[model samples]
Target: MSIKIENLTHIYMPGSPFEKRALDEVSIDIQDGEFVALIGHTGSGKSTLIQHINGLLKPSSGKIIIDNVDITGDKVKLSDIRKKVGLVFQYPEYQLFEETIEKDIAFGPKNLGLDEAEISKRVIKAMNMVGLDYESYKDKSPFDLSGGQKRRVAIAGVVAMEPKVLILDEPTAGLDPKGRDEILDKIKDLRKEYNMTIILVSHSMEDVAKVATRILVMHQGKCILDGTPKEVFKEVEVLEKVGLAVPQVTYLAKKLKQKGFNISEDIFTIEEAKYEILKLLKGANNND
Candidate 1:
């Protein structure tokens, strides 16, 4: 589903001495099936913004339109809005309390009041999407599985709900390299198979560069940059001032350009860098 936010502003403790403005007239449009990475420093309103999208937190002022429905309307039910926007928070594995993986994944579908047959189908489908073998892991205790496996099960619960938009907040927060890769791969797979709009709130520029088709940079309660990965990363100076950085490979590419090598500074991924390097080598060989 597509999302439109217009003049969105949010505040905390409105009448108190500790009142703070968490978001300020932040507006963004996210088209269907777009993987958008929301990046910002800690307390830069990243978390507050995602909460508003899912209707978990109400905006102090502004409109959040999902698929043309104004969720901010007083007449609109938050529960109905949530059905179309599923949020998977960081360390989702800690939320798992079911006796088995199957039950844990089935929880959301069951709450939707789906019948047994349909619920079972969705549970199995969700497991497969996250790369968990239904036959092998279905009956196992979620807590007994490895950290990555437990995290997948937790994510499957949200996937089974089959929301039109999936919002993941720091999905790879504390995983090791292998576990992190597993989660990221599942995210890619989910987008491909489900065609859901995914908003990923992350701190790792490398992870976003690898998967995000678009990036949104937030700072001091305002959205300062919104563009494709290359366009956003090109503002390295601005991002640095906001306490953010582009992918490490993008820095390397910039250094190569400075050293008089013919390389694109926009190259942010290892694969892109390797291809550019190979092309340069091929050109030198032809001259030789």
Candidate 2:
């Protein structure tokens, strides 16, 4: 499903001494099947903005249109909107409580009142999507799994809901490097395999550059930048001013360029940097 936010504004503690504008006339359009990453430092309004997408929070002013429907309309059911847009918050494993993995993953589908057969189908499918084998993990306690496995189970719970759009906030927070990579791979696979529009709120520029098709930079309650990864990371000065930076590899590439190397500084990934450096070495060898 597509999402369109127009002039959205949200205020916290209105009329109080702590009144703050969490979102300020922010606007964005996310098309279906796009992996959009939302990046910003703390207090940049990234968290607050995702909460408004599925109606968890209401906009103080402006409109939210999902799939051409005005979700901000008074008569629209927030519950329905939520089903179409599943949100997995940071450290979702902390929310797990079921005795067995299957039960935990089945919670959302069961809440929808599906019959036993359909619920089983959805549970198995969701587990498979997250790389969990239903035959082995179905009866295992969620708490018994490794950290990465537990996270996958949490994400499977949302996947069972069959949402058209998925929003993940810091999905890899607090995990070791290996675990983080596994989760990111699962997220990438989910988007391609299910064609779900995904909005990821992240702090890691390397992760964003690796997977995000587009990036939206949020700062001081406004969306300061919006474009593909290549486009957004090009604004190194603006991002640094907001306490953000491009991928580490991008900075390294810039340093090489300053040394008079025949390499492009626009490189965003380690793989790209390696390729460019190898090509430059090949040219040097030919001249020798």
Candidate 3:
């Protein structure tokens, strides 16, 4: 599913004294099967913009076209759009309420009126997609699991819905390093397996740099930058101006380059930085 937003603007409490603009004439195009990472500081319209994508919120003055249909228009069914676009909120594990893990994951498919056999199949598939073994965790209480396991279950619930477009808002917000990697790896695997269009709203520049095929930077209710991670993170000064920081490795690489080291300033990950340093060392040894 491709998504196109044209002149999209959204406001809260439109005629009231406390009315505020949350999205300001933001326009962007998201192609099918693209992994887009949306980044911004708090109050930058990141949350507000995504809500419009799945019909949770309407545009105040523009149009949102999903798969060539203008979803913002009155004739469009919001429910239908929602079924195609699944959103997993931050700390989604807190919302789990089923007696068993399988039931929690089966909830969405069950709600869709899928047959018993199909719903069970979907629940198992979804759990497996998130690295959970159906036989091990099926009958366990969600609240009794670890933080990361609970989160995976929560994500599996959304995955079972089989949305073409999956949007996650801070999926790894409170996870430990290992837990974070698990969630991110599952996301990567899901994209490859299903060819789903993924829009991830994240605060960790390191996480986005590692996984995002494209990055969208927002500032004060507007989309200020959009490009590949390399392209977007290269503008360190601009990002800093908006109270956002690029990955620490990118910063280290930039400083090293400025100090006359033979290193690439565009590096975004620890692995990349390590490779560049090793290359520089090899060059030095050759000259010696």
The global C-alpha lDDT for each of the candidates, from Candidate 1 onward, is: 0.93, 0.94, 0.93
TM-score of every prediction relative to native: 0.97, 0.97, 0.97
Candidate 1's TM-score: 0.97
Q: Which RMSD values do the candidates have, in order?
A: 1.2, 1.1, 1.2
What's the CA error at residue 285 for candidate 3, in Å?
3.8
Candidate 3 clash total?
Answer: 0
lDDT digits (tens) for residues 105-133 of candidate 3: 99999888899999999999999999999
The per-residue C-alpha lDDT of model 2 at residue 246 equals 94
For model 1, residues 72-191, the per-residue Cα lDDT tens digits are 998998888888999999899989999999999999999899999999999999999999999998999998988888889988999999999999999999889888888998999999
RMSD of 2: 1.1
Tell how far residue 90 is off in model 3, in angstroms: 0.9
Ranking by lDDT: 2, 3, 1
